[model samples]
Target: MHQLIASPHNGAFLVARPGARAGMRIPRALYEQVASIAESGAPLPPWLLEGARTAWDLDLAGLTMRDTVLVRPETGLGYGRATYEINKGCNFNCEHCYLAERRFEGLPWVGKARLLRLLRDAGVLWLQFTGGEPLIDRDFMDAYTFAHRSGMLIEILTNGSRLHRPEVIALLRELPPYKVTVSLYGATPDSFDSLTRRKGAFKLVERGLAAAREAGLPLELALIFTRHNAHEVDAMRAVADRYGAARTEYGTISPTYSGTPEPLAAQAPGFLDKTGVFQGCPAGHTFFHVDPHGLATMCKVGRENPVDLMAEGLDGLLRLPGIADAQMLRTGGCGGCQLSGTCRVCRPLAKAYQEAKAPLNTYCRHGNEEA
Candidate 1:
């Protein structure tokens, strides 16, 4: 398979570091899929290093990456869903962290400089930063600086603990974010802290949020419907009201994490409200997730090896991954299920169905359900 060992960036060859350990070996077929994304002949960085197979380096030029191997690109240019684990780890041990058990073990800080360069070079317009808690990133300014300079709009999905402090708040007002998506587990620090397993997280998060508002950044509130917090969602709304962020609005949790402790099955049939106007969960096809390991997939739901990203040059993320190719959650459970409105359909779980796996049956009854 053809591999571009390194691409020159800013007139400097970005060769893999001297001790660059080999990435998960990509199959020939998968490598071809990635090639199609870079068919436009976009000047690419040498992100891949090839192992000597058959004693020769395969030339990658003119090798079209197949569209079938990549995730579907977003319809409108200048706007697409982008999620990055900015910190590669989180400080809080939130009760629902799917990556919590493996948080500390993901890839180390890859430097915001390279991440933003890749995103800009790939033509990404909007970016979503998620983590166990992204505020804790020491090199966060570097990332913010790069994304802003590259004309990328930022959306921070944060826990709000860091934004509450007056000093942090003052600094936030000085360098306002384009938008903030705060995940509010509970309004009061007592409930929020208990749910997050951190004693003063609630207070810190709340204060950090006040700081963001005091700075006038547009803010959106994301409420995950869990048994522990569903009972007081209105209180969470009250927290939003205090910020005068009426223009910003609501969000839902993903049902894929229901395997944990949530009583949605007993609370309501669906976590989504019928009046809501959002379409089905279309993340994988519309958004891409690159793990700290650099394994690119259609969305955060996926748990498979390099899907079609190697050959694609990071731009062909617009096509859909084939049904048989995904290692994800079940489909019978979500193929035609009724929870689209409540739970953000887990692409990983949906991959299960696309690949003909057994339905991992689950029932979440959080909030009010129509049927």
Candidate 2:
């Protein structure tokens, strides 16, 4: 197992540890030198040895390049980030889940290995594993280990129900992830269980959080506020603080990825935050999302014109940028809207709202006016 990874990120070179949040950006000359040293089976340079110790408290003193460092080859692909849904299966049935269906279907282990290799070949370094609940997937551990060994910094988006399991904790301890982001539904059992429609759900979450905290895992909390638990927002914050994990609050609820409007009913009345101006994102150009069955899309929202990675391989991603640009055009209901200049939502998101027949005030400046 390598302790450090040196990879080309976008147009730059970065040296990072597997589980660390911070990385050292090195010059092109230094990256080349490091690569040469790895090829020559020489010891790591003194600068990297001392820097790793000071920056991440990692001691790489006498380790040679072959044993200490994994030099990731540049694939010439611009992609640097990706999100893969291991499976759209969750142990809980949260009313506001963005996935309309929670089917426990995905590629077999052999196909999953092929997909991971394809992602690595596509120059994906920052990878996130998400799902209805990723941890519930039977092959999650195997897939995660493969990705981590492939030199990708991984972040797991989970519901925290299974974090208390000894096997999960042991694997996470052995090969730490960059982050484990858990969704906080409610602070108390009654509210949480009621919201998830799963009895004893809160206890499991609490136990999971406690175990993760004790294990010193890199954890974060996504406080999902809905009508079901809006009153407990403060309590949720307190829970996050208690665990010493970073927290982010999400109040607005969007329709499912399939454009189903049922999830919108759970939105908290006055808790919706105002979205900022529409700056562009590098969804398909530099980042992309892959579903459980190896279908790659621009992002989680714009699921149109997917590239079947399993069938078409890494070359299929060449179609993504064009598909992404086409999806972002201000067409359909937003085609002639003059206010699109200042529209907060992107075209893909707006299309979902339009498909759901969501109230204009929720996503448009026109309020209740007809489109």
Candidate 3:
């Protein structure tokens, strides 16, 4: 396997090691030089030799470009990042899950391979594989290996249920991911199992975490706070500390992607922090999301005009910027609100709250002040 990946990212060139967070950005001329060296099997350049050692502790003293560097061909398409939902199936039945229905379905292996290629053609360098639990998917290893070999830095968003499995751990150990983000429900079995509605869920996840840590896998723990386990916030952080992994906390909850109100009931009281001002995001312009069936959208929340990648191919993505712009517009219920200038919720999110008939205080500034 190549030790490093050299690719064009959003019009700039970057050299990153597999399973590493840090990378070195190189100029276009240097990228071209590296590509030529790799193609001709030239010796490692002195600059790269020293830079790789300094950045990632990687030594290229005896390796040629062909053995150490994988030069990804440049695609003029501007996109640099994407999230692909491998499958929506999950073993856990968490009440706070944003999916109204956790359906166990997705495209077959052939379609998945094609979609990854299309993403590569569109210049996607940072790819995240998410799901109800991506590790449980039947073809996840195949798809992950394919994408990794294609020069995309991969991240897996998982529930950590399968991290204890020998086969899963072995695969990940062999082909490391940039990051494996596991969601932590609670600190203890009672809270964790109760929240997930699974009798042995906590034990499984605990085992998974231990196994991942032992293997030195790049791991991040997402500590999720819900009414069911809000009291265990400190304990959950302790769990992350014990594992020696990076961590993040999530307190706010949202309605289901399809506008179902069920999940909002799990929101922990006093945990909802006021959202920040709505600065425009580069959703469709620089990054996009893909559902199981190869349907591409601007982001996870704004699923309005989707591009069917399977049917329309990469050219279909041409319509996404317009679709993203349309979805972000302050139309419908938000058409003429006086607070639009300072509104924290974007139009698509506000629309979901409206569809769910959510209490105004949950999402609206006016409702917050009234409360």
Candidate 4:
């Protein structure tokens, strides 16, 4: 019998017969949704499934992974990726905002019960704190505290606006993998202010970055690639070099958001480089997101195959348009390429680019080219 067994704590499902793994197949609807919108109505082309199988590392003919290991964290991209919109609204507003309607909305939070259940059911080992700026959320501690309690690794993407706050400092002091990824627009205020369109951001970000490093938090100085800062790559690296153990990664911005999509460059089609395999992109399968509006999506962009989390629990979300069957969908740009699981191709920027493009054209995509 085929029954979908899911956990409230680890967001995954096991579909199998009594004891066999060879006959299992993830539902077909998953493929239909993620199969290029151009191919949505057509039969899935052969390359798609071949690529998906290759990316998922499934032995189509032999079933290399045992049925019992289907939901094991070690066996798959279990609890793959999650973007927690701690602070749903933004203040800097350079451009391309889907949440423009929420510009002045208060920083709401995910309930403690809901969050713990998400962590436990999704097996969400990797949690990303995002939003208007994760730092600005009143429940930043509440979210961080839950991640810590769940014993998951975490990374935070921020505009670097509030690192100086005492409570923000306290969370970093106690969290694990307390990675602070800052989107530095330029080396100085003149150019930086132009990108974020906010005054005094340059000084605040610099000081915030320093405070994070001094506290010994793992720091990744992220440079938002754009025509404006294209020439300042060296200066950006110089900033990274100062931090002995900190990293400096570079990436291009995507102009996919419907409003003011292009911050400093035009949109790139495919959003992905179309050159590598993410080795795995088991997003909706492992981890997923529930936006402020209570929509549950695989990633942050919230456009593709979005399942309203409020209407449906985790199990129902997986059955939505884009994720019905877990195994049949392609991991998009990184599904069948050589990089496989080592690339960060399914990031928020990538998602935005795919959904529209502005966020990607103006964000970072470097670090761990492999998974």
Where model 1 places Cα greater than 4 Å from the true spot, the runs are: 1-79, 100-102, 105-112, 165-175, 247-286, 307-347, 350-371
lDDT of 3 at 261: 96
Query: Per-prediction TM-score, please?
Result: 0.60, 0.96, 0.96, 0.61
**lDDT of the structure predicted as candidate 4:** 0.53
**Total clashing residue pairs per candidate?**
31, 0, 0, 38
Across 325-364, the per-residue lDDT of candidate 4 in tens digits comes to: 4323435543564543444454443544454433432333
Candidate 2 lDDT by residue in tens digits, 228-345: 8889989999999999999999888888877889889888888766667787889999999999999999999999999999999988999999999999999999998877767778
Q: Report lDDT per candidate.
A: 0.50, 0.90, 0.89, 0.53
lDDT tens digits, residue span 173-263, model 3: 8888999999999998999998899999999998999999999999999999998888998999999999989998888788987788998
**What's model 4's TM-score?**
0.61
Better of 1 and 3 by lDDT: 3
- Candidate 3: worst 10 consecutive residues by lDDT? 362-371
- Worst ten in a row by lDDT for model 4: 1-10
What's the ranking of the predictions by lDDT, best on top? 2, 3, 4, 1
- Score candidate 1 by lDDT: 0.50
